[model samples]
Target chain A: MELWYSEMHTEDVKFSIRIKEQLLADKSQFQQIDVFESNEFGRFFTLDGLIMVTEKDEFIYHDMIVHVPMATNPNIKNVLVIGAGDGGTVRELSRYKSIEKIDVVEIDKLVVDVCLEYFPNTSVGFKDPRVELFYEDGLKFVRNKGSKYDLIIVDSTDPFGPGEGLFTKEFYGNCYKALTEDGILVNQHESPYYSSYAKSMQRAHKRINEFFPIARVYQAHIPTYPSGHWLFGFASKKYDPLEFDSKKWNELGLKTRYYNTNLHTACFALPNYVIDFLEESKND
Target chain B: MELWYSEMHTEDVKFSIRIKEQLLADKSQFQQIDVFESNEFGRFFTLDGLIMVTEKDEFIYHDMIVHVPMATNPNIKNVLVIGAGDGGTVRELSRYKSIEKIDVVEIDKLVVDVCLEYFPNTSVGFKDPRVELFYEDGLKFVRNKGSKYDLIIVDSTDPFGPGEGLFTKEFYGNCYKALTEDGILVNQHESPYYSSYAKSMQRAHKRINEFFPIARVYQAHIPTYPSGHWLFGFASKKYDPLEFDSKKWNELGLKTRYYNTNLHTACFALPNYVIDFLEESKND
Candidate 1:
């Protein structure tokens, strides 16, 4: 059988590639992970019907999703990542020396097992003493958690099917409550190019803004994601990601493939459509 | 007939939608140009086999391509755009008061004619007195041109059919010659994600850098374009787009969907893969 790895950018759009071999398959964790060498799209990795990585452009998605919010809040010592089962986000987040605790809440245990087995590099930080793995529903985890975090990063899948609740205003509200006073929260907002998710993003921003004093939508270029352009939502109680000390971020000396202090500020400078949505929501 | 619009991010990957009707079709130019109201990907427009503008999200591509170079050189008075048949680039460029003359070289008369008919908003700038339309090959125009331009923007199609030459080193060298001493040249480099056209881009950069003092590649979030992330090449003799006067650009009062002074500087920050290519080429 010709194995192919496909990523659903949306229910209507997907990108697929022929694969050389299935690297690992763990049915117990509800994840069948595979690493395949491909002629195009570089080294392809997939888990639970989702594309985890491609050799040609993994850093763009991994670094932007992790580092932007981390850099935004310099005092972020405790971080929580929801649904980054593949551990790519954790690997990137581990680079920060100040991060004393990195908690990963993934619903699927298979994804973690497969990632550790085949995609070792992405899962390298999973075994670190600073990291804690939680096999629980992301929405429930945020709802029930008593401990406040300095930074919470939602590196979940698309806001459809298993990931539907991830996009709800309720989850965002819970996230707002779960963070410390100066806490910052970042979530993977879907492609504004294709779905009604932009409205969902706007709605989430509205709800989060009601709780937190600051909420902003930023963009990153992720080719495999639907529409190739993906938006990330940042909500903070007091700190603005844009007003960071650049000299300090430079001193941290994170050898990044993408994210820097210059980019950290620029990513927040959203396009007019996004700005208009925020403005329109205020009037409503 | 139910017309379906598909944006093939690559030959292997596509995102499509069914349309209610074909809004306009003009066969006067070298390629057939058509616009349609589509259920997915929004208002769809096509030139030949290439997707041009979809009502939903074209500003990402248009603004990044136009404003990056314009921001780099604030004193730009005369601008030349090559192969922007839709006139989206012109609409963006025309916003600046410093831009006195805007010349557009498009080989396909059909694209311009159809754009004027169907995509009137994008084509609106063509009626501006400062605009000059040349229905000729961009390469041919650059070779024969005597006058120099402060900025040259290549807003051509992909490097497949008619646009094949636009991606070549010869075309870039000619673009170098067509600009004034302080002139800057910007072209839509293909996606660093899917298209290994980075080699071609690197080659062009090498050839152009030999003549021009500085050349660099910047990125934009263009979901419709191949790989969802797009790269733009900037080559200049004197001006750096990053060190421009933001106060003046703010005064230009260019109502843009995406480009701002912050983004202008941020676009130049490259990923390690892109930087590696530039460095590799430098060593060679």
Candidate 2:
């Protein structure tokens, strides 16, 4: 039988690569994790129904997700990452010297184990002393936690099947309760071009804004995502993401694939339609 | 007969809608232009195997293409747009009172006519006396033109079939020769995620950089385009895109869909891979 690695950008759109072996498949978390060495795009890891990384373009997604929220808050010593089993987020988050602890809550232990075995580079940083792995439901873990985190990063899958609840208002409210004072939360919202996803994101942002003092939506261009254009929601109690210190970001000297001080500010400048949605939702 | 409006996101992937009628089809141009009223996405436009617009998301692409270069060069007066048959660029450009004259060079009369009829809102400002239409090849028009333009915008199709030559060294050289001393040139480069188109864009930028003193690449989140992430190349004889007069842009008071002062500066911040490409090309 021919083995292939596929990333379902949408229900109808799936990008696939023929593979020589089934590196790993984990069904417990409702995700089939696989590692495939390809002739063209390089060795890739697919979790749930998405292409998480290849040797070529892994940095682009990793850097933007971690650095944007971290740079926005200078005192983010404690970080919580939900659903990043490939360890790419941990790898990037480890660059921050001020980050004392990174608690990763991934439901699937198989994804973590497969990534460690096949993708050494992505898994290398997870062995750091600052890192703690908890194999459990991200939603449940956040709801039960007593201590608050400085930053919460939701690097979950698409809003379908197992990851569907990730886009709900209830999940967002639980996240709000899981953060400390002056805490900031960033979640990977869907593509704004697709109205279905954009609508869901807007609804989630509206719900989160009620709990947090400020809620803003930002954008990043990731080619592998549904529309190539992806949105992220940032909710904070006291800080505005645009008012970060550029000098501090520069001093961090983080060699990143995408995120920078200029981009950190620019990402928050939403298109008029999005601003209109926020305004329209406010009247309701 | 079932009329379907199919937007080819890539050779393999397409976002299609079943339509009831052939609203408008222009065959004079190399690509067939069609506008149809769809059940889900509203009125949509497709050209040369690509999705140009839908009633809902047109503002995002149109505003970013026009406002970014205009905001970058605040003193722009004489503007020249090549291949903007839909008049979206003209509509956005007319928002600036600083623009004294706007000339558009389009190869297909049918595209202009169809857009004028079907997309009336987008095509409204083209009737302004300051705007002049030229039904000619943009490449040839620029070569023979005697007048120097303050801003030149190349809103052409993809780099294959009819628009292939637009992404050439000769075309960029002519564009350099056609501009005023302080003129800025902005053209839609292909998505960097696709290697074939990305390499072509890299070559075009490499050649254009040899002629213009400063050349840089920026991105706009365009969903219809291949890889959904689109890139634009800006070449200037004088004036940096980042060093813009924000006060002048604010005075213009253009209600845009996407382009803002913060995004105007931030879009130029490239990822490490793109930066590395430019650096490597510089050495060669």
Give each prediction's DockQ, rounded to 2 decimals.
0.50, 0.42
Compared with the true structure, all predictions reach lDDT values of: 0.76, 0.78
The residue-level lDDT of candidate 2 at B73 comes to: 81
Q: Looking at candidate 1, what is the lDDT of residue A26?
A: 49
Q: Residue-wise lDDT of candidate 2 within A1-284, one digit each (tens)?
A: 65555554433334455555655566654767666676545677776656777766677778878888888888899999998888998999998899999999988888788888888888876998999999988888889565479999988887776677777778888888888887888888777666667676777677777888888888887776666777888888888887888898889787876777777887787766677776776566
TM-score to true structure, per model: 0.86, 0.86
Report the lDDT tens digits of candidate 1 across residue range A1-284: 66656665555455666666655554553445566776666566665566657665677888888877777677788888999887788988888888899989998887777667766767887977899999998999999566479889988876665567887878888888888887888887766665466676666666667777888878877766556667888888888877878887788888887676667787777666667877776666
lDDT of 1 by residue, B1-284 (tens): 64556655455555565667878776653566777876656666776746778766677778898887776677789889999888888988888777899999999887877778767778887988899999888888889465479899988877766777787777877887788888888888776665456665666566666767787778887766666667888888888777788887788777877777777777787666677777776666
TM-score of chain A of each: 0.88, 0.89
Q: Encode model 2's per-residue lDDT on B125-153: one tens digit a residue.
A: 68888999999888788895654898899
**Which regions of candidate 1 fall more than 4 Å away from where they truly are?**
A1-14, A19-38, A42-56, A73-75, A143-148, A167-170, A173-177, B1-12, B15-37, B42-48, B71-75, B96-98
